[model samples]
Each structure stands twice: as C-alpha cells, then as structure tokens.
Target: MTTSKRPQNRADWQALAETLIPSLETRAFIDDAFVDAASGETLETLNPASGETLAHVASCDAADAELAVAAARAAHARGDWARLAPAKRKRVLLRLAELMEAHKDELALLDTLDMGKPVSSSLGDMAGAIGSIRHQAESIDKVYGEVAPTGDDSLGLVLREPLGVVASIVPWNFPLMMTAWKIAPALAAGNCVILKPSEKSPLSALRLAGLAKEAGLPRGVFQVLPGYGHTAGKALALSMEVDCLSFTGSTQVGKQLMQYAGQSNLKRVYLECGGKSPNIVFADCKNLDKVAKRAAAAIFHNQGEVCIAGSRLLVENSIREAFVDKVVEAAKAMQPGNPLDPESFMGAMVDETQYRRVLDYIAKGREEGAQLRAGGASLEGPGYFIPPTVFDGVTPAMTIGREEIFGPVLSVFGFDSEEEAVAMANDSDYGLAAGLWSQDIDRIMRVSRRLHSGQVFVNNWAGGDQTVPFGGVKQSGNGRDKSHHSLAEYTELKTVWMSLQG
Candidate 1:
C-alpha cells in the first residue's frame, strides 16, 4: 500500500522515518490462514527506533502451537511437503526467494523498525536471507546420498530423509537471516517447519510466511507462530510429535530448550547460541590501522547483539595503546543514529531490557576497576542507544572480559604471546568464534588450530557465508547453521542393508 515510502536516498529515508505510520501486518499463519491463536489474543510489537507500536501480533499460546503442529503433521502425512521431489521442492523455495527479492525493501524496513537496526544493515540482512534461501533451494537436488561398502553378500545404502516437523526458535538479533539459516535447508530437505521468532522481533517472520504461501508452498508446510518463547517455543519443544528443534538464542535458553526436548519426545535439538568471541590483535608485520577499524566494527555491528560479536579484544602489549586509540576513533564514527537513516551505521539496541542490561554491564566494568577508556554512557534518545564503550586493563577475571555483554562495548586485554592470547581466549564458558589479526602465517595457523572455538577468522571477525559451516562449541551450543553440513541437521540417515544371497 505504501510503495512510495520505500526509501531511495538518505533524505528519503529520513523523511520516511519522520512521517511513516507503517501499518505492519502481524498475525499467526496456521494451516495457510492468517488469524489469531485459539485464545484470540494480540501483543503489540513496537518499533525499537522510536519506541512506537509497529504492529499488534497474534499472541499464540500452547493451544495455537498444538494446532500448528497438527496442521504440519497433516500436511506431512498427506505427502504435501515431506514427499515432494527434491527438484520440485527447490522450485518452490526458489520462487519464494524471488518474491523475497522483489519485496526486499519492504522486508528491510520492517526489520529496521522492529529491531532498531540500521535500515542499511537491514537491507544487507535481507540480501543475506534471500541468498541463503536461493542457495539452499538450488542445492536441494544437487547433493546426493551415499553408498556404503558392505560384506560380499550384502549391499548397504545410506539414505538421508527429512525429519518431519522441524521447529525453530530464532533470535531477535538477525531475525530474517537467522530464520533463513534454520528453515531453508529444512524445507529444502522436504520437511514441514514451525518457526517461532523472538517476541522482541516477530514482524519479519510473520510477513515471511505470507511470501512463502504466495510463492506456492503448500498449506501447513511453513508456519509462523508469533509469541513469547516461553509460550509457543516451549510448546513446540515439548511436543512429542515434532521431529527436530533448531534454535539460535542465549546459551541459557538453548540449554532450557534442550531439556524441554528431552522431557518430551527426545527430538533432535540443534542449537547455535551465545558467544563472547575474542578478537586477538597480534604484533603482526603489518596493518594495525585496518585491524583497529575492523575490530571496532566486529563488536559494534548490529549494536553488538551479534552472537559471535568480538566482545573481548586481546591486543599484543607492544601495540596496545595505539591500536586501542585507533579503535576508539573508529567507535566515535559509529555514533548511534536514527535506524531509518540510511547513513546510520549504528542504531538503537533491540529493546529497553537489552538496553538496561548493557548499561548494567558497563557499570559492572567500572565497579570491577577496569579502565573505561572510551564511551561509558548511553546516548540521549527515545529508543535504547548506547555509545560504543571500550574498557582497557580488562583482565580475564573481570566481568566485562568474560561475559557476553551483547552491547556495543569492548573489553581490552593485553597478551604477552600467542600462546597466552590463545589461553585467554579459550578460558571462557563459550567457544563459539574467535578472530585474529596477524601476518605471520605460522602464528596464524598455530593459533587458529589451538584456539577452542568453532569458527576462527584469520584476519577478520565474524566473516563467512552460506558456503561455509557456521556454528559454535562448548556452551555456545552445538550444530552448524549454514552450508551442506546444516542440511544434515534436518535429516536422519538410515542405513539400508540388503542381502544379495536372499
């Protein structure tokens, strides 16, 4: 209805922000119908940018989740999605991707409003999500099953089949992209999916279900349940009929979901959880300037709600002060701006609770005696905005250095050697991801191998694609999200042994 509101320039974006009263669609899609849950309740989804109500989403409950699961089961039993040929499934997903591309700007704007991320960054997220969908769609028919070597009288076949009724609980940080990461492969493998997006940001997921339906995905094949995790997410997890649960959120929540799975049907649970990823800056042969800039970006991107945010910065003692100064300068440039502004590199925190939590961490840093070198205050704005804060002299024991702050706050530590840096980085409850800025190939190889992290970025932080496997280790949770490896999570491998003598 408001195609003209699609911003083409900074001025246009700014104008749209000022005058836009976007009437966002918010409803639970079950059995291909847009309506409320059984209880007939609604919840207000607010714009994180201006703290205004964006949409009133359907507040789905356990009963609604049950209805959705029943629909999915019916669809699966009827051979609507789970029995489709891989190529046909790919076509449906590809069409969905095309539609997503056609309305990318609309989706991007919805995400920006819903989660307080910069509109420019939301566009990137839309691109990533769409790319993920298309790639998984194209890959559906390409990957082949395996043949096993067996005894002389026996033939063995290893076949991969879709695990029916995959339910996902995606986080709010990168809602659309994370949704794509979880559902695309599952759908491509020919499974019905139930997505319960984070209550903090559910608009995009609700909108996405419509796009999927319009793209010709069968009823009940893909459903979006918009509600709190404790309600819909718990209900989906506790269902004995649901086959698998893939989640991306806090480590604590992930562990709880795993318990819920065990308490119910023992559905396979795949979790990609929290991270306090370390960004190690060795006294390399070159490029402190570039690394400093990247370091700043790594922690501050998405207002630091990123699961693999390089929150802990380990700087070689030699370049500590100078590198930190460069980082501080970089942070200064990333000042929080209106989310609708195309030029706003850093926007508000996702919501008020997270905003308060971040501020609490900053206080903890000061109370623990870590030197607050840069920003240590929240920005004066309507929405939740925190200045990019840096804390130097942050020891491993300090709260700032150990915890996943989930804010645009950096904890700086000095490392004497590569081994020490590796030790400090690994000395955490999490082993999700780590990043290093060094030119020595041997050091790079050795440190990367030695670090206890799922993903190691050689010269960058949190950089990769759908082609690469992305996941974490330790308390950061298990299972990969992207690549061919992710496809395995949604499928169960059955070994078929046939006797030739029979």
Candidate 2:
C-alpha cells in the first residue's frame, strides 16, 4: 500500500485504493482462473498520475488468445451462455450492473490511477458506464424481432441468433465505459465474449470480470485478456472461429484490423476510431458563454483523449475573435494537476508516449505559423501533465488542424458562410463527430443534414446516452456502438422461408 505521493480526499476512495492497489492480480482471467501470459511475459502497469508501479500484468499473446477463443466456443456450443432465455440473460446483466454500481468508487479510483483521468471525471464515467450496462440489460427481452405477413398456406419468420464468439478490443481512454458499451450488449444478445483491454489501462477491466462472475455469469461466457493490440487483438481478429470483433481506438489501427478481417475468416469487425471533430459556432448562437465553457470542456476534458473531442473550432468570421477570446478565457482556467484531487478539472496525459506526442504536436503548431493563445507547455511535476492549449489563425492545411493529436490542443479556423463551414468541417479525412451551436432551426437542420459526421450535436458539445447509435463515417471507421443497434451487431439475421416460396 504505497500512499506516499498519492492524493487522498474523502476517505472512502483512498481506503478502497489502499485495499485494492496492493492486492491486484496482474494475471489474465481466462476460463475462470487467473493465469500467466502464455509467453511468460509481463507488463508493468503504472499510475499515469504519479509514475508509480501499480502492478505487473500478464501480457497475453496469440497462444493465450487461442485458449480464450476455444473456451468461448466450447461454452457457446454447450449452451452455457447462448441457450439462456433473453429474460434470464437480462437478469444476469442487471445483477452485474448493480454490483458494478455498488463498487463504483473503487472502480472509479482504479480508472483514475490507471489512466490519469480526473478523479471527478472518472467517477462520472463510472456512472455512465453503469447506466449503459443497465440500459442494455433492461432492453434485451423487450426488443422483439419482426414477423412478416405471408400467404394462408405458410408462415415466414425473421430471427436474430447470437453470433457465437464475440471479441472486444477497447481503448485506453474511458476503458471501463468502452468495455461496458461493447460487452453488455454482447452478453444481452446471448453471446460469449473475450475482452482484450488495453495494456496501458487494464485494471478496471480485470476487476469487472470478477464482478461479472460474482453476479452469476457462467464460466467461459466472459473472460479478460490484458495485452497489446498487435498480439492478442490481432489473434482475435485473425481467428476464424471468432464470430465478430468490436474495436475502439485509432483509425490507423482500425484500418489494420479491417485488413486482418479480410485476410482471416472474414469475421465481422465494427470500429469506433479517431476523430478531429469540428465544433462550429455561428454568430447567431444564443449563448456564447455556454458555448465557450462547454467547448473548453470538450477539448480539455479527459486531457483531450476522447475520440469525439471537439478539437477544431470552426467559428463564423463575424464573431470569431469574440468567441476565441471567451474560449481562451475558459481554457486558461483548466489546469492539469493530480488526478486523484477532487478539485482538479484536468489530469495528466495517460502515459509518457501520449505526453511526448502532445508536446510534439504543440511544436508542430508553432512551426506551422499558428497563433498560440493559451497554455502550451508541459507542467513541472512528477506526472505526465500538459496544460490546455489553444491555437488561433490555424489553416486547414496545418498539421495541428488536420491531425488527431488526442491531447488538450485546439485549432481555430474561421469561415464566412455556412457553405464554407461545412466545407472545412468535411475536408478532414476523419469525421467521427461534429458539434454545432446555433439557435436557428433551419440552419441547424441544414448543417446537420449536410455534415458527414456520424453524430452532429445541435446545442451540446459532446454527449450521448446509451440509446443513441454511435460510430463514425469515412475514415473514422464503420458500424455503430450503443443503443439497440449495438445489441443487434452481436446477432446474425436469419430469414426462414416456408413452403409458400416453393
């Protein structure tokens, strides 16, 4: 129990961290038992905030991935999961969600320590994760397949069957919440799942598997393998036996997985990848203050690690300076500090790699002749901390404006007309999400329809309930997460034609 450099407020989380951090089992949870990586390799998980060792987790490779897939297949064949009634599965997941909520504080702490997200923000992420799991569980039995009308002589049926073995590869950012987004629906749809958590943030996902088991989820129906994408994740994608794979991460990695799917048994692959989202504001927006505040939160929240971060500020030329000033004012207030501190709005970058990458992007922005408005330098601390940065006079051709930095960096570009705004927003190779702030219904309607993004937030900057379908268009990747659409992704559509066809 190393609490020497850690920040502790509100005795509960501190106590829980003390209790869990020392006793962490770094081994992968496979077939209901903790085991070492098949390669006998280990990865040391660190507290991104304090640069302290949390645990040395097992790094599962292809061989271990094979073992997990075999277990999942056998379990599905034995009807350990797939044969459960929809209602029964729903109950099991409901209990799982309840257990997760009960230990929300502990889970939130683990999330914060593992990935340098603010303690407060991690707590909110846990709440959302619970809601996502519960929503899917509650809706499992309520959703019904359609029955088509047929001739008097025969009947036609359309049904959705579980896709046997499902594999989920989640990102380091919002690890637990992304896990909930993928696996909850997969479970409710009566499919066995193999969760491959990012090696950088595997603690909460490992704990979640234990919670699922505690809620009476059958053995082999759920398993967690902590490893890198190239080894374990590739194995899942390369497996002919794996029915489907759901992934969340970078677009480059997403494209690689898609190619792996083609080279393998052609398993179904759904990806929610990178974004350089445009947060456009028209002069007609009713609340510039609200826009400035939320827009700052949008780019600086989670250290700007979000896939749908509003990184590009596309403002109308008429009010560009005023809005930029307000945004700069807001960003200057979000200081990166100790993740465990309750008052800290921003936290460290997830690790040194991310920290270096953000610094590199900041340098690039300066080299490309963009105006540096707010904080841009790394903070003096033990942790990997970088202050929120704003760049004005950014051209679409610049690297900062075009690339996904995945850090607290904002690039502002001005447009004179609606056509120019839409053009600049759509010019990027990525289009996961876009945000627009305008009160005019006609303008909102027109721009919302014209944008190529998967989601266009009207008044809000970044937000989505579990009921909404999420995923991106173009290079942002294919398919959808959340909502019944996500639940449906884990099932195979089968149409039964009767004698009427003959």
Candidate 3:
C-alpha cells in the first residue's frame, strides 16, 4: 500500500531507478533482519549497464552461512512454519505474492540494475515470479496424503513431509525468477528456506526478503545470503544441518555441489544446469520467414544469457544459406541497446567476465572456420555490450558449435538428410531443450521422439508454461523447476503400516 505511484514511462522508470541506487539495501537478511557478514567483508555489486558501482553487498562466507543454517534449523525444529496448518501456510504465501505485485517495479529495477537486463524484460520476470508464488501457494492445501490398500486387520498410510531445511542457490541469468522457482515450492511444502543468490546479481533476492517479512512469514523462516560460490555456496552444500540443496547453475558447479553433499550429510541435491539446445529447420518447414525470425529471437534474446537458448541452428542443406541470411537480417534488428530504454530489444552482458568469455568464443568460431555473417564485436562503451552474432558453415567439430557460450552468438549448421539432422541435434553433452520446424505430422512425431531433450518445440521456439515441468536431461542436470512435479522435490515420502490383532 505504500507504493501508491507507478512510473508512467521508460524515462520515469530510469529516473526512479537512479533515485533508488543510492539507497539500495545491501545487507544480508539473516534470522529475519538485515545484518553484515560475520567477517565484515563486502563485495561491490556493479550496474552492468553503466559500469558503475551500485552497492557493496555483504560477502557472506562459511561463518555467515553457518549462522543462517543454525537459524533455519532452529526455526524448522520449532515448527512455527513447518507445523502450521496447510491452509494457514497457503494464506501466508498468497499474501507474499500480493506484496510482490505491489512492489513489482522496485524488484524489477533491482535486477535490471544489478544484471543489466532491460527493465521491460525484468518486468516480465517479475510477473513470472509472482505467478510462481501464487501457483505453489494455491496447491499447498490441495496436496493430500494417500491410503494404501491393505488386507483385513491391517492399515497403510502414505504421507509426504517437508525436508527440514532447504538452501536455494540460483543463477544470475534470471535472478528473481530462478529464486522463485526454487523457494516457492520449498516454502509451500512448509520448510524453512535459506537463499544464496549469485554474487553477480544478488540485489533482487535481498529486496524480496524484506517483502517476505512484510507478508507475515515467521522470523528466521526465510533468509538471504549474498556471497561467492566458493564460500557461502559450498558451506551450505556441505552443511550437515541443511536437508536439501537445489541449484540452478553450470554443470561444473553442479558436480561440485553433488560432491559436497557426498562429503557431508548425503542430503538430497537438485540441479538444473547448462544446455546447448539445437533448433532444427527442415526444408519442408512452414513459413520460412516466421521460422527465421523466431530462430533469431531464440538465441539473441536476453543477450543470449539463457540456459536453454537455441544457440545451435541446424538447417537442411538446400535452404541453409537462405535461412541463415534471413536469420542474419533478423539479428540485425536486435542489436544491443541501453537496457533502461524500453524500446531496446536487447541488453548488455551480465558482467565483464561473461562479456570477455563470449568474445573469446566468437574468436574461436572465426578461427575454427565458421563464417561470421553478422555482428561479432562488442559495442564500444563503458558497459559490456555485444551485438547479436551469427556464424555460418558451423560443424559439430567446431568449438563454437560444441560449447555453451551463454551469449548472443548463434552457430548455424547444414544437414543433407533428416537422419543427419536428428543425429546432429542429438550430438551434444546437453539435453535441455530443442526446437524444430516442420509441417509433416509424422516427421514431427518421429523426430521429436528421437531428439534427446527434456522439452521439444515444433514449428516454433521457446514455448512452455508454468503448468508444464521445466528442466533438462544428461549433463544438463537432474530435477524439474516448474509445475506440480516440482513440489515433489521439496518433500520426502513416508509410508506407515499398522496391524490390529486385538
């Protein structure tokens, strides 16, 4: 209710964001209050768009992580949150979702300034985050225990119970949204949560902790720790008190978390990691122009910081050059721009390290004999900006075609047969998601089944709702993020059997 005024335009949003930067909350939220790290260490969170320092957030280490875990453990044991009635817990989460909507603009701006996403796009992330909370809350009371059929004089009961304490480690690409994806279900399952947001974009998660308290969550039930992965992240993963650890990051880091779990309490770990998803275009596709535009957007959107981006484009040989040309034309329209401008279709890289890493991949692409048909260089400015890049004559053997660049770079390949296309698409360490364009229903069904991916989009790209499950296969990591299935990840199943002989 305190947020009575709304920004009317991009200029208003930009101005409001400027006013907010100086006063941004940079402390970690531990045991329901803002506090400094135990080591008194801090890390400067930079505005990737302007290349300016935003604030020095608390750099939580093992000590701070220990404090947060202790608080969460005590809260879970007290049952103030875990033992609350299902309907009451649902009400609290609904209230939290309402508060999120009320503070949507501020939350969106925090992420935009921290990670250099366009404010317009961050607003959409806010919508997704709010919807995620609402959806999980509504399902809390509806999830019911089951009774197993038993013989006479015997009874069996099946129950699902929350894990005691959960630690959510999320990536920066979709900061708030990824946090919501993990915490919503964990909280809905009646578990205390400790969030360790990526250091590159920790602002939004810190802001959400305040709104969570305002929405009537119990003290110590939810907390946020902003720090490096080696310290805070590793501490949580290796903690004996933490019951479950859910992470969305790289495959390399995901492996480390699993190792940490094995070295500690052997707690459950859920991971959603990297991807090299392929978007295939058949010669018999629908409208080439429409597919071309979609293909372009699938890679170039979000400055290509998406985990499931269709970075590899596989086209039939007969139409490969023409389709690549159309895609190049489309990419030209999506050049990087100032993220604060609502009209800007694309934004800067999340930070300097990722910016340089992407440029290195582009260089590799050129050196590996892939043709640079479109933008390949960073825009000259203070911030990290890279335009949409497309490479032609890409082969599976090339470095760019094989790696997950995590930038606005596309590698195009040509295949002569349908079998070759399927083989080429399936030939990768990742099996996250794939996109295909074809009119023949039989071919669609056959190829979709053959492709080794968790989700497949036919005749389009990037199509999915929260109602359906989201995650990946193979090295892409285990566990699902969205839909009813995700709720299962936060809970443990127990079956009780009893017999009466009296």
Candidate 4:
C-alpha cells in the first residue's frame, strides 16, 4: 500500500511563490456610475520601498465626499441594500471573502508596493482580511433582537437595525485588513458604506470595492474615495448625510474628527487611534530570551507602524540590563529592505513625512538626555526607510516616550516594583494594548487588572483572536472592533412597549 505525502511547510510557501508576480498593478476603482470629483485632480501613489510611482488615485475633495455620501444615502433610502435580509447579506459577504482569497497574491503585492510592509506579513494581512470578512458573514444572521415578556393581549418586541450610510476611514498601516474590518461588518449589518482609504496606501481599498461589486453587491452601496485626510476624511466626519463615521488613525486626528462631528452634526464617531503600549517583563518570566525576542518583534513589526505596538518597554530593574541586551540583539538581526523580498523583516516608512517625523523624534530623545543604544538616522536610498533604533533611560516626560513615533524605535525604561511598573504603564494618555511577560499567575492577574488598556497579553506580545474584542481606552478612542461588540456598533436598537387592554 502507498500513501500520498503531505507537503512540508517550506513546500507550502514555495507553492505560493509560483503565484507571486513581481509587477502587478491594480488600478483604483472609481464609481464611474456616480458623478466624478468636482476638483478634477489626481494623487500619485508611490512605492515606499523603492520610491517608484505606482498608480494615480483620484484626488477626492469635499464635493466628491458629498457625491459618495449622497449615493450611499440614496442606496439606503431606496432599500437597494439596507432592505436585504441578514442571511442574504451574509451570503454576499461570504462571496466577497471567497473573491479576496482567490486574489490574495495580487492584493498582497499591492499592499507591499503601496505601504512598504514585508511581503510575508502582507500575505498574512490579506489572509486576516479574508478571515474578518468570513467571520462577520457567518455571524451576521446570528444577531437577533430580544422579545420582552408581555401580557396575552399584546406583544413587546425590540428590533436591531443597521445605521444607514456609514463612512469608513481607514489608516495606511494595515490598509486592506482595516478596510475589511470596517466595511465587512457595516455591510453585514445592512448599511450602505462610503470608504475612504488613506492617500498613502489606497490601492487595496480600491481593489476591495471592485471585489465587493463582483460579489453581487449593488452599486452605490459600496464606494471608495481616495484623497488627503483633511479633505476626504474631514468631509466624512462632518457630513450630516453620513449616519456614522468609523476611523482608524492618530489620536490627534481622532480628536479633530470628534470636533468635526460636533460642529457639523452629532454623528456617532468610532475610532481606533494611537497607542504607547507597555511590554512589561518581570524577573520570573519564563523563557526570558523568547519574551525579549517577541518584545522586539512587537515594536519593530511593520517598521513599528502598528497602532498597538509595544513601543514602551517596562522591565523589572533586576532583569532590565539583560532584557535590554537581548532586545537590542534581536533588533540588530532585523534588516530593512525591499518589502517585496520574502526574506526582509523590516521595511520602509509610509512616506517622507513619516520618515522625517521618526528621525526628529529620535533626535529629541537624544536631546532629552536619553542614551541612544543603536540606529538613529535614515537609510541612504530612494525609498523612505529608517533603521531599527533603541533609546535607553527613556523617562515618561521625554517626547519619544510620550508620542507615537510610528517607526522602528523602542524606548526602554526600568521600574523596581510592580506598583511602579503599573503606574508607568498607565502614565500615557493612550490605552490601546499592553503586554505582561511573567510566569507567575498572580502577577499576570494583578498587572492585567491594573493596566489601563483595552487589551492585555500574558506571556505574549500581539495575538488577536476573532472571539476577543479589540480597541482602546481614553484618547486611544472609543468603540470596539472584532468580537460581538463590533456588531453592536453597526446596529441601532428600537424598543416597542405594549400595554394590554383587557
């Protein structure tokens, strides 16, 4: 008897390598069915890894946002989308998931070219995007309204309905995945959505609109407007026609969005903003080297572009030096290179502006009397890349410690006691996510409970399961993504009270 052999892990990736194309360009999907932008301008997308021009994205202005919003409102009012049954909508979402999976390689390449994340990581992001859509699709029909107990003569019912005309603004970092996170749930909830992808990385979002169309979604139900944040993003925030706004970006921009919502109309605003999250390493941590390695990866992943990066390293004073040494070694091992290369770990920053911003922050750290352990300047190339940097003696007051650099820069600080560590962790205005590395269950429970963050990791850095809610506290913005809580955000409740007349 003979049996077929299963492919090894190396062979699996090699199979995917056959599908990878070096030059794949997905043109921006404009809603030709709707009116064009009044400005009649275009924005050029650049490959941050090589500084080469990629594609020309539509430069949508206020008028363009208005057109998109009007189309969404019309789609909702006409019941072209919002009237669909939850199960039918779920089917459409499932089709979308299938389409995304079919074109995973193309989408991954587009993401790498536009945003400068490693191809390996970009592929993972594409997979996660598909998973998010599929997860939301499966859960859409499971959402049910409550039926209140009432007298025999009458019935009391509660209805959960979609918030129509949703405006989704996604950040450049994790562009494809974040867009799917917002649009999938919004559409599954029966809302017509207008998506605004960040100008820096708009390719995947545009391609997603095309995929949604292919999935049997009606026109005007899903639209993509790629432009500057000030114009397109602000328009969505302030538009009275838009029912609610979902945004993911910086804390400063989140505040501006809140102001816009208040100034124009009191639209519900949901944001996932910046984080200066702490990665605490206690003396009793099992596998100290492994913890340190993960800690380095958490901060340096995507060139530290993630909103939940463990940028602030808080270690017990007893083991601070050793942990720092390990972390520095791990950081040194990651070499920045072309995002399309499978071997590269670190990639370029989003653009010149972000590159300069990270450099300036590093300079500020040095001026504030912090010791620069490694890498402090930009790489010499056509692309916008920064080396992995680490700063020692980082006080809470220093700019590098407080601000979101959004680059491959780690700031290390030491604390003597558990109380001090917790205090230092909670010192930041942003409370997105925090991590604790320790073997003691008591320490994990205590520190996890004390930390002022939305998500906490025990003996790990970044691990997101579909079942758990992900978001932030305080200035990190309100509302949750993933889990059942995200489903609640897309819906509105209506209660019907009945009185029995005997």
Which of the numbered candidates is closest to the native, going by highest lDDT? 3
Candidate 1, residues 171-286: lDDT per residue as tens digits?
99898999999999999888999999989889889889989999999989999999998899999999988999999999999999999989999999999999999889999737
Off by over 4 Å in 2: 1-12, 500-502
Instruction: Assess every candidate by TM-score.
Output: 0.97, 0.97, 0.98, 0.94
lDDT of 2 by residue, 423-495 (tens): 9999999989999999899999999999999999998976778889989999999989889999899999899
Error in Å for residue 231 of model 2: 1.0
**Candidate numbers, best lDDT first, in rank order:** 3, 2, 1, 4
Q: List, residue by residue over 1-502, the lDDT tens digit for candidate 3.
A: 2346887677887888878887788999999999999999999989888889999999999999999999999999899999999999999999999999988989988888899988888889999999999999999998888989888898899999999899999999999999999999999999999999999999999989999999999988999999999999999999999999999999999999999999999999999999999999999997898899999999988999999999999999999888988999998889888888877788989999999999999999999899999988889879999999999999999999999999999999999998999999999999999999999899999999999998899987878777888999999998999888999899999999999666
Candidate 4 overall lDDT versus native: 0.85
- Of the two candidates 3 and 4, the one with more favorable TM-score, higher being better, is 3
lDDT of 1 at 216: 95
Runs off by more than 4 Å, candidate 4: 1-36, 151-153, 500-502
- Give me the displacement of residue 310 in model 3, in angstroms: 0.4
Superposition error at 376 for model 1 (Å): 1.0
Selected candidate, larger TM-score, 2 vs 4: 2
